[model samples]
Target: MTARRSMIRRAAAVAAAATAAVVLAACGGGNDSSAGHEGHGKSPSPSASAPASASASAKQGEHNAADVSFAKGMIPHHRQAVEMAELAETRAGSAEVKKLAAEIKKAQGPEIKTLSGWLTSWGEAVPTEEESGEHAGHSMSGMMTPEEMDKLQKSSGKAFDTAFLQMMVKHHEGAIEMAKTEQSNGAYRPARDMARAIITSQSAEIERMNKLFGKS
Candidate 1:
């Protein structure tokens, strides 16, 4: 009887140890899965983050004098377009003309801000409202003179539609010229990208305006 009891006790102890080992293995598996999930949740380390940021800054600052000139010249050039577009709200006769004016104002307004921001970020001076003469005859393409702006501001109705389309077509043509130059000579990727966008959008607008002029 005593021998039998000893054997039974030994069996119980063995079973208990086996159970503990199985429990430990299950817990370990769960912990490993949790650790793997946690690793995926973390953000990229600073070493990786720094290089991406530095590369973008480098691209922005890598520009040549032509890039700087483009931004400076284009900012004011865009501002004049916006100014002309705003005049159409009160002066334009055709619904189509008004719509186009609004589109130009909407698009160019933000572009002006973007160009100014790039200039500031690149350690270049942002163009001022009164800086028309500041660039020493670099002459922004597509920009209206003060006299032309006054003339536009003074007109109304069908006369306004005719004048706006005529002037804007010429203006867009000039902008395309400048953008082409930037695409060729500009160094900054973002500036070059902006140039391409200008070329595309303005080209389309030019076509639309030409159609409108033909109908008029």
Candidate 2:
């Protein structure tokens, strides 16, 4: 009886040892799996996120000098166009001229703001009204001389309509020229897109004005 009890106790001890071994192995595997997951998670986050942020920053700041020049030049160009359009409200006789003038103001007013915003974001100077007047005398194309502006301001009715249409056609041509340059040389996407838009819209307006001249 004593021998039998000792053998039974020994068998129970062997079973417990086997069970403990399995549990320890399972614990060690779980720890290894958890550690592996943590390592994988940590490795990808910084590397993956870093490139994404850098790419975004690169895209945001992606602009060349041509883009800057486009924005700087277009701001005042648009401002002057708006100024001419405003004169048409009071001076123009033709209903068609008034409507076209309104459209020019509507289109160019927002563009002036957009160009100014782009310049501001690029840390460039926005053209002031005074600066715009100064630029009108020299570098910018299609800008009316002070005498011409004075004439437009003084004239009314059919005379004003003729002058306005003639001047606007010339102005749009100049804007189209500038826009083409931007399309060719500018690096910023938004600025390039604006250039394309300017080309399309102003070209159409020029064609319309030419037709109006034919009618006159």
Candidate 3:
């Protein structure tokens, strides 16, 4: 019962994260459909508008320059982790597995927002890296491949629990790698701190997951 509860909680958090991110991104982070125009008036002459546009563009460009590297790199990075968490929520039967998923979702969701906030402040598009390819079965730390996700999607009971634990272990490790990279190369201090914290917590979680899966 506890395990089920935990898994449910984690699932909720992951769903919330995905939902919130899409909402926030839609609202402001990525596309500014209104950027070039103002209320149904004749378009400002480029001669007059050029400087404003250029300035806005320049600010956005700088924001991208300053923040893009973090958002671009982190978005995909967090996405994979979220995917892994989602898998754990559905398949994991153990309280530990569910708890891990919740932790992952909680952590990454905020990080996603932090990065999104950066882009919003900078007035730039959300980095586009995560959208480039199919995420269906791509593997990371312990993230299942397509086959693996397929298996989990089909399995039930203990089978799901074991697989979830094993896969999440690997997925978390992958996340650790990305986090380390950000810690070293990410432009923003907060982003870098997020990377470091992910590494620390996930590394600890990896050990726990290993024990749960008897991989220890």
Supply the TM-score for candidate 3: 0.57
What is the TM-score of each predicted model, taking all chains together? 0.70, 0.74, 0.57
Candidates sorted by lDDT, best first: 2, 1, 3
Better-scoring candidate (TM-score), 2 or 3: 2
Ranking by TM-score: 2, 1, 3
User: Each candidate: how many clashes?
Assistant: 0, 0, 6
Clashing residue pairs found in predicted model 2: none
Residue range 107-200, candidate 3, lDDT tens digits: 8887887877877786777755445235623533334466766777787557877777776777777767767766665566666667778788
CA shift of 63, model 1, Å: 1.6
Cα distance off (Å), candidate 2, residue 201: 0.5
Q: What C-alpha lDDT do the candidate models reach, one value each?
A: 0.87, 0.88, 0.69
Looking at candidate 2, the ten consecutive residues that score lowest on lDDT are 131-140
Q: Which candidate should be chosen as best, given TM-score against the real structure?
A: 2
Q: Give the poorly placed runs of model 1, Cα more than 4 Å off.
A: 1-61, 132-138
